[model samples]
Target chain A: MHEQDTEGVKIGLEVHCQLTSLATKLFCSSPSDYRGKPPNTNICPVCIGTPGSLPVLNRKAVTHAAMIALALNFKIPERMLFFRKNYFYPDMAKNFQITQYDRAGGVPFATDGHITLDSGKRIRIGRMQLEEDPAKLSYDGTIESSTQTFVDYNRAGITLVEIVTDPDFESPREAREFLNKLSSILEHLSVSDLNLEGSVRCDANISMAGGRRVEVKNISSFKEVERALNFEITRQRSLTSKGIKVMQETRHWDEIRRITISLRLKEEEQDYRYFPEADLVPVTLTKQFVQDVKKGMPEMPEERAKRFQKDYHLSGETAQILVREKALADFFEEAAKHSKDARQLGSWLAVDLQAYLNEYGKSLEELKLTPKHFAEMANMVSSGEVSRGAAKTAFVEMLKTGRMPRSISEEKGLKVISDTGFVESLIDKIFSENPQAVQDALKDPKAVNFLLGQIMRATKGRVDPAVANRLVRERLAAAKGSK
Target chain B: MTKKQRQEQFISEKEVEHLAELAKLELSKKEFTKLRGELNEILGYFRLIDEVDTENVSPTYHVQDIVNVLRDDTPTPQQPDMLLEDAPQKKDRFIKAPKMI
Candidate 1:
């Protein structure tokens, strides 16, 4: 095995999720709603680490952490201890940050968990811990050239659930997929909104076979995470192929430049000398308390996706995509309530509506279309009240004006022309006007489609193509009989 | 210096220099020697507590036995300008620090 080698890559993620759903900071009563606020507004004595101002852990923060743990199927420890992670940074008002350490009598809120991706690949979760968020820092210019840095303490002291993952991902795409699924799970658990700035952040460590590991940090978005990993993988492979060993170092993702830049060498001491946090006592969670939290847990994405496939007869892929966003899933269920045909509603939502949203870079929440109207539109198409094309037209109009599908169809004259006599008359007129076309239709069956196209154009595409085709054939046969 | 000084010296003068570097302080040669001696004496006094250790004693993290201190998750209006007024240097609403290298 050692003689010949397969160059395999290993990836691990350390993801940070902000517990914005909680009401207060991790250790203080200051508002956790720090986003978009002016700098330093949310700062309190305890958050800014004022001397002699002791910290009291927020009980709700612990509950939220435990809820996330249960949602991820992690084993909640009996007693969770906090530790002082000693570091020096302006963002940390306290020179030492209170975090969960794995050693030195430090116990995190949860440990030993795993979440499976939609592909059925399991990614083991190392630990999930609760920690305080540091302040926000902004540079006046490029970080390398800036003459000054600005600090906003508004984000300081907010609680964060840091989830660490085992080295399981073999590709950038798998890592991205894992993050998306994890974010959806967190959203479904109501532990996080996942849309707020800095609500979720990821740091990835990547290494190729026989190559030193490189850690990429400061990747803010899901897409950036994938791109950063991809860039690192290629960089490492090229170095290894050229007989150059990859240096183990901390790299920064220059998102704008779309490249990874080395930030620090391995020789630098990572002195986060963690010791037990003396201000706050350990959080004790009994089995009964965990059971209570577990009882209130909502159905996660995996179960809901399975239900969608089983009940609605949706495909596994479609169900997976639909359940990726909780709001979209809710919309699907709401529309399903109005229409008995789940397949019709599922296809429209998962395909047409989703396509439109993607085209305009809009979200389901941003669209003005309601589920009631969406269901009505789907019903109209299925009931032969409107052709599929006409229904789609009404959908776009409804999306733009926020009007009901019925009223939009009425206003746009999109109602299907299903009356047999009226369609016969329209075909009769088209035949009389185009004698050459009629002669051509009598000679060739496909020529009747030309006349049918005319009726469709005259009716503004409200006439179903099948009905138009049938009426045109009947009228053409009647003409041939008269001859 | 305290009377409870330990015979064994744990923190050397070099260790003081390293600590000063980490704190980003520039200590003069005279000040370095003076501070090193004072810090060592302080550590020597702290060593006396090691003699009374009980191996079975559980670690105490906090003085109070109370737990589960929490506040309702809600926002209270804050005067950001008032807080910024205390900063020695500020631009707009943010506190300014030296450009990190």
Candidate 2:
């Protein structure tokens, strides 16, 4: 389907991903796993900005950010500095967020990179910086209507890496594709788990027809980014077509209403007095350290896709699908280790198993079917111990019950009946019952399918269709010879 | 110099008001004038550093000659109940604040 002509539309994205792989908060010894804990329970003095508490940087977060920088082809500076961005908000007890700045004698963690979308459009990454997340605030109602707000400092001081892209996306679809690709890269780096709720957030800036830029914030999910941009673009187009000027302002994406409401006017722009953060020292990335990080990098998505195609003899489409998700690709590799037919196993995973996953709206990690089970099912089909149809039934049962394929097949009587004596007797009974149909099959090749259908119905779809086909054809030819 | 000229030479009352707003400070008229005068005096002291003409010297972001003072990514035990004892207002386990719009 052709997308609507979004001519003259430009969108840029600022994605903030939490470095959830770290064991502790960015500047404190508080645990990073604070999703289910009570509010303010996982916080420390450094995170909550208690009086006289100093912040010490988490070394692993920097290395993880460096790995992401390398994966995206960013240039790491010799030294990176943190600045205190001064603002007054209840979410931050410190009243100033410790972050990296590219201006005012401060350098970001990395800069100058690009990620090419599947459509081959290169979205230039302007910069990637490290920052701390603010505490989460929950309202009794909506933000505008709520009278009281509860503060949860558990999420505060968590390490966040913000990736800013240049205004290179022409449409919402392209923006969504870029985010998916970025997520895949992050997954391969083992830096962050994107599946966690509120783990990744995006803010988008969009403009059309030389209008002033409008930023849409609070896009909490990957899918919502596209929806928010589409809504913003349509809203702007309506205004521009009516000869109205799009005002430059910040808007919030209301997930419930599916609209962008003006959060603040550009006139009330924040004056974040950024200055050097004295509590934390600068992190020096020497050439040796960068080289060490680069050396320790794992296989990225692109390389894994290429390897899948070459090593497993998989089609380009299948390889692309498998590698699009790191978990699915890992599952395929583990299954391939024990299967004799890697290509078959790859297609079963990329196509059939994926269909079931999509149908059930569950992720591969949530499934009970193991790689060993998948390999066993594929091997059974390869060796003709079970028909493809029977194996499919067994596969479904396995998914539902978390049972092994062999046991499921035995319980459901789905194994192929390959015994020649039993099959010969069934065929003889069918021939005696329908001699005229047998004679018709001897004359017409297409009539053989009718006989095969009969055999299938008689065997309750348990017979290997290939074995039954050969036997029925042989029996028909012998009868013709005798006549 | 006239009072207006002296005020212009240092910091203006309008600029002081803007800074106060940003810092979420509710300042009275007298306090604003006092802060403006005190801030100008502080700025006058800082202006002495402008005489240094080492144009080739890079800007110093930190006074200490240290880099990479980092801690390992390890979690220590936390006492939430003890920490909550300091809250002025609490709802369940949460820190409650005034109505925010």
Candidate 3:
């Protein structure tokens, strides 16, 4: 039987990204760097929702949110309003969460934005709103088996911008691409560091062929988002093929089990009873304010990639690889300023340097290698100061020791043997040592490469193979003429 | 109709039960009936506002005539030990709660 087609799959994502760039919590003066701190240590009267405490919004968070909205092509409202979404959960010390609502005299931070994937598929954003994150709850053991649970209020009031997208994705891969593009855009804005754990979270709603939509929550990473969607699509397909109707419900992605488990359905539909938050006055975003934010915005990944292609004469693929990470692109641009061959430098950084980073299990920041080192290395290879192979060897040494390329090359004797007299003497010595090989070279042209290999082994790749090959051919022709 | 007759039509016992459930309140049978009557009286009082002819008036979101009430993103020193002193149940530095499952 033919496999089920995934063309009818529809996936929409509600992504929550923390505004980690800010120093304090959204509504309180508590520090926002709660990751490594002890539990319940980062709480305050306002964040923990003490009875008499009133919430004061953070000004920088609004600026960061506006920058993000502009980057994603969202429409900023003239005035932004906050609402109280009432719900009962242990994660929230306050019964109601302060969030932005789109209806009932509430205007969200932004709306009607779209991100275009590399495949030219545009994922329309429904709305973007600012809200406070809930406290983190951890069980002593598994949730079902734990005797007690603990709550850490440190994360309770971190500012988060939740972006809800229209159900425009047709497949799991498309959804993954959209997430990657969004993450790159977020990184360029520098509003949130995606590398931090729990910095970005996504809840996906997926359906098959107009079936009942199932909402999957707790997807923690981009890869897990694709995995959960693939698993859900398969589960729904199996149910539909058996003539069973898929139920509309919420599920949790079990990261360890690699499956989506059904969460207990509430007896009644959740009535959030949203109302205007009287504690926080509405924020009026003026045109000048937005333009000021736009002025401070950094060049995004897409624009950077295009600039790389135009200025550096780099291949589209190479430019994309370099620009995927903001730091890597910055490194490339810095090195290109001093390098003789920017195109070669771009390729080396994009391909070889990335491989070294992966092999050593290190990020670019952890490496001692600087842009000056990269520029020097690229210039050496282009100027025939060192063979590409010898430069690669020196490159590894530089990665390990953080030394300059010139010093590493000098210490390792990796510089190309450009002296004609020195190379001729080495070849003559090789001809005397391997007389049998010399005879073979005179008889068969292919044997000349064997003599060149011997010279390379002696010099430890210090001699350029091209120069050695030319010298070997000239000496062999002279010997043949003499015979 | 008398005010008492009109107030009785405002809130029902079933609605009171639903509200009690939402608020996590455990109301006895007598309490439910008494609370329902009290809630109806409160609603009847609010109904008097409907008599005003204010069609063009905008809804008031906040009583204070202010906008952009915000602070800089700077952290102040916090006393976690002092803050955790008010918790009824504590485990180490965390606030311990009942098993969710």
Clashes of each: 1, 0, 0
**Full-model lDDT, candidate 3:** 0.90
Off by over 4 Å in 1: A1-7, A264-267, A356-360, A384-483, B1-18, B26-66, B74-85
- Candidates sorted on DockQ, descending: 2, 3, 1
DockQ of each candidate's interface versus the true one? 0.42, 0.66, 0.66
Interface root mean square deviation per prediction: 2.3, 1.2, 1.2
In model 1, what is the error at residue A89, expressed in angstroms? 1.1
lDDT of candidate model 2 versus the reference = 0.88
Q: Which stretches of candidate 3 lie over 4 Å from their true place?
A: A1-5, A351-369, A372-377, A380-483, B4-8, B12-14
TM-score for chain A in each prediction: 0.82, 0.82, 0.80
Off by over 4 Å in 2: A1-3, A241-244, A264-267, A380-483, B1-8
TM-score of candidate 3's A chain against the true A chain: 0.80
Tell me the TM-score of candidate 2's A chain. 0.82
As a whole number from 0 to 100, the lDDT of residue A363 in candidate 2 is: 78
> Tens-digit lDDT track for model 1 on B1-101?
34435455669977887788667689999999888878877888777789896799987766788665555666555555665677789888888987766
Q: Candidates ranked by TM-score, best first?
A: 2, 3, 1
